[model samples]
Target: MPDADSNPGNGDGREADVVPGNQGGRASRAAALSVRSLAVRSLAVRSLATLRAAVDRIIPADSWPAGWEGGVAEYLTVDPISADRDLAWAWPELISLAGRLDDEAHRAGADGFASLDPAAQDRILAVVAAGSGARSFDALRRVCWEGYYASSEGRHPAGLDMVGFRGVPEGVTPIEPEPLKTVAPAVVQAHYDAVIVGSGPGGGVAAQVLTAAGKHVLVVERAPYLRNDQIRGDHLHGKRNAVYWPTVGPGPGHPRVAQLPDGDRVLDGTDDASVYGLNADAVGGGTRIWQGMAWRFMPEDFSMRTLYGNPDGASLADWPVSYEEMEPYYTKAEWQLGVAGEEGGLTRRMPRSAGYPMPAMGTEPSRELLGAAADRLGWGWGPIPLAINSVPWDGRAACVRCAQCIGNTCPVNAKNGSQSTFLPRAIATGLCDLLPDAEVIEVRDGTGSAGVTIMADASTSPVELTVSADVVVVSAGAVETARLLLASGLGNDHVGRYLHDHRTATVLGESEHPVKPYIGPGHSVATLDHVHADTIPWGGGVIVDLMGLLPLTSAGQPAPGVPGWGAGHKEWMRGERANLFGVFAMGQEIPLPTSRVTLAAVKDRWGRPGAALRKDVHWTSQQVEDGMAVQGARWLDAAGITDIRRQGGPATASAAGEHSCGTARMGTSPENSATDPFGRVWGTSRVVACDSSLHPTNGSVNPTLTIVANAFRVAEHLVAEWPR
Candidate 1:
């Protein structure tokens, strides 16, 4: 196929050379001819073929469409080469195994490796599916299936629209006449009606709403704004900023904390040997660096206690409000955050007053394959609801489907994170002020209220600025917010307590067909079937995008017998990019009182106590494990995968921290919780804790949307009670 760059003028030239054959004369003929030429050239077709060949080598033939030569391959091939390479390198042994399959197929009288009879194919593939093959083949197949089907072609075939396909929504204009180019001083003493700490979904939205309401607002962020030029494509470079500290396990520079086997006293930020998956010190916080998924928790997710009662040794309580109270806020978040999708679908149970502000983003081959599999299984599969624009909504352009949606911010303002949705609008209102590079040191109690003391900049000279407000909202995330409360001596006893995160594990296997896994979103389009169950006590599971592993990062995966690096490693690495998928379990963790985050002996660059987390997920409940197994089996069955193996036992340690929540929880009573139902701190009448810190219990879905909705609810209360 001709490269996209090489064929820039091809379409235009074809259009100009068409002969008139209709009543409309030259114009009509030219249009028809152009379309015919485009069909004949089949640039898209060839690209798809290449992608199919790559994916087929990774997954089973049953996981893909009947004819693998369709648009799935093209969609997979359209992604960035860097992403493709990363997906390929995750499973080195899969590359060698695929080669063996080819040789075996040739010996078995097959036209090509993937074209063998189902029984014979399973026989050869079996070597890679079980035992040692389980790890390599499972990883390759999962990644490839996810990567290919989640692409534009894959999504369309599977019946989902592309996100950010057109222009931004009508009437919502871009912030006109940009703000002053000069950076504001690190500290400002100007009094405002509201002061929001942390510029994530919670704070950003608060700033916009309060500012628009004519209240003077100030947004304080610990990190500076990241520019487009600063973004890196290389995984190592991305890791420096994206990955949490103490990159290597049990190494020096790792934060230390005490841990308990059972639920007892917990500390925040110090436990969990894995790299925490939170946002960097950037303007948008986690929003600037997160997978673009936006899902509303099920109704049962909100009221955990009312439904299942409380779990033994866990603080699993019902949310103060039901999903009904937050329904409008969900809509508000979707429209404001620029979600793209069909409102009605079997998987989508929420009621919408209006359709998506924009159409859905295009799908890739991986999504299509999964969709097909789901259809075959008679299961529900819809476009993964996302905070991405199909046609530009709220002034940002639609996504080009660069295939790097997870872990990286978009260069174009396609992904609707805090920066794209709220910061700009907040700044434009002029009623709001943002102070970047300002880190709050402590929240000292004043005569009646509390005053925030902050270190303005990185300069040697210490400059302290105090701001007293009638109300203070801490949206600094679960870890930072808990640390701040502890540092301030406000709720030190409960500050770092009840640290929790999703207990994640991966199930992998390989396929007989090409899956072309690196084409679109980096996560699964279809969630696992065992997500909902009121009677059964279990955390839910979701299908993840194929695990895209870069060469340097691939060193982390020992994979039982595979060597770190060698000639065999390099050969395996070549095919590793497009061949893996993991059924990632974002299982709800049973919050133990012992899990906590406390002040570490070590300090950050600002001399403030760095958070030391002490987490204990070693006692993950059987319910979670059962749920994971159920979903894992279903996903493998749908994908027609063999030789499946589950990584990490029910009580094993995990490597993710993005879904961590509930260090400082919200409840009706202060003795049982850290904050009030309105998110206000227990003792303080004015200070409120927003962010995931206020989540009493972490649900199975990504917490950002819920966080935003709760923030809106908090903002509404504040606005209603404001001294008008």
Candidate 2:
């Protein structure tokens, strides 16, 4: 048997206890043994009974197997959630909730919650929802759904069938021909021409550029290299699932302190989406599991300050490089990464030198409905540019249009990320070595002796090593890159300032037609009309026809005041949830100097100070979101979709940090920015930042394409300036 350290499912590295036909008898026997052994290590009898009852109530057996019978209870008792390291703080509350359920049941004159009639149990649950136990109730409902929806690998297979979800396309699996070649810590060289601190879009592009130039490169990534098999498309537990914790992460030992106005709360990367600001930490970083929307910034986006002056307390600045300058690089990135999209009909006008390498993905049904609505509204709309293959491109297969995308890895190796493209190309040259599961704690800055202090196997038995490099590039995302510079005692006072991200609002409505949303990438057509609408406050954003409505994602918005559990909620899931469509608007937030990352007093397992965040999204960003929400609702109404509901906006400012950037912003001077125009850290010539951290202002669209383009530009510049 494999050791627990090697496991992805339950920590024993064994295949999970899936249902018949999915696994062999040995795995089935192990699951059976695990279920039987729960009495010793699982919840007490009363608590287990209460939990089982709760699960049944959340997802009742109307036309399908109930949550209680469909492996939910067993899933809760086993490896992933039960002994999850990151979710350790949540278990006590779950235990308490079980005990509280019985107390409530007794008040209602029942022997126990599980012993009460279904209707009676629901009445008590309603009382709990209205009372202080509301939070606990929500938690229970969430865990129940996660257990049911995320564990459908044979364990609740019927639930997926009922929802019209076809599993991974036939014969689809992880596409890497052999295991990814990685350099063991013992074999790593003490010196390199270039050492990149991340393996994300930026770092990957940099590696490809430098290695192709015959420069020896070391790519250090803190997270483990997640094989496709390891990234099981668990709806609630995968890398993209922000409901609890992202599977790929800043991990257990590396916690951040959110300095909220209420108080300083220590947070895991998954604690609060708005405040924690988590990007993936693995080999491809966010690219491995991203939705692959490759959007180009409008020309005006580069001149944010020139278009609309800064809002009060905002650090809005124009990028040192313009779209005209970056256009060639953008084209290069699009072609290299294999984007699929149609040209023209952009909402906000952007002059493109060339079209996408591949044609747009076949329009999803939701986009057709919304595109007609946009035509009626006289808004320019076109297919969303995506870094995913339409046909077999660059040796990768085309997307199978699986219901699961965004958070899940591409089973067919169609989703083009740094993992699939740049990194592999760099590795093929044998000039670039990737060091996964290694954390660069600090960069030693000097005139000619640039190097980094690395912690190998950071999550386990860590060993410190010092390695020298002629050039050092940091691409560890916005917050992490800023934190790294601060931790390394590098950069100026502006090192972690001007932090911001895209604030978004999603307007959901019941489509008049059956726009099968659970197919393909979440969004298809996006309009640029909102990108620079004068009617919008501060600035405008883009609106996309969004899809991918999983059971848990649907549960996030219950029908207004209706109880989260019981027959009414279940009915909502079956009817309204099934016919749902979404219009999502993402707005670029105003960067505030006050919104910064600093070194916190709290230390990690490695005894390093944690990143402290004081995230402040300006009111204008909220107004931008609100304006977009109004437009989205208008579009939905025009599309004849009724029962409109708005889920996000500036009100969700705390969680508005997704697509986060602009921490170590770029500028002309060291006094105002962490890095110069060429991505060189102001104070140090050898150290450079190659990620979105150098973004002076974030665009209204996704940043991956731009990050890749900019990294390519910067890497090319570095090679030209190399001491040849």
How high is each candidate's TM-score? 0.69, 0.89
| Candidate 2 structure quality by residue, lDDT tens digits, 402-520 | 77777667878888988889999999999999999888998987876799999987655678889999999999988889889999898899998987777778787777667865677
Error of 1 at 414 (Å): 1.1
Query: What are the runs in model 2 whose C-alpha is more than 4 Å off?
Result: 1-54, 78-117, 127-139, 152-158, 170-177, 269-274, 561-563, 654-658
Cα deviation of 70 in candidate 2 (Å)?
2.4
User: Model 1, which residues run further than 4 Å from truth?
Assistant: 1-183, 239-277, 344-347, 445-449, 459-462, 534-536, 544-564, 601-608, 618-622, 648-656
Model 2 residue pairs with clashes: 7-13, 274-654, 274-655, 347-528
Candidate 2 displacement at residue 644 in angstroms: 1.8
Residue 430 miss distance in model 2 (angstroms):
1.3
Local accuracy of candidate 1 as per-residue lDDT tens digits, 1-724: 0000000111111111212121111123344344434432442333323223434434323323321332334333334332332232342434445555566667878655556655566566665466555665555444443343232211332201111111112342322222322135553654556667888898988887788788777777765444533442323224222121111111111233333354322212211223332334466776775656787777767776776666667667777888888888888887788777655442365555556666666766666766777777766666667787777667657665544555555646577888777878878877777877566777754445556877654222446677776567788888778888887888635666887766555666555554644344445465535565442255464554343333223323424345332223323334442354445555676777767777777665556676766666534455675667656656666777655667545534322255667877887787778887878777766677878887877776678888888888888787777632
Give me the candidate number with maximum lDDT.
2
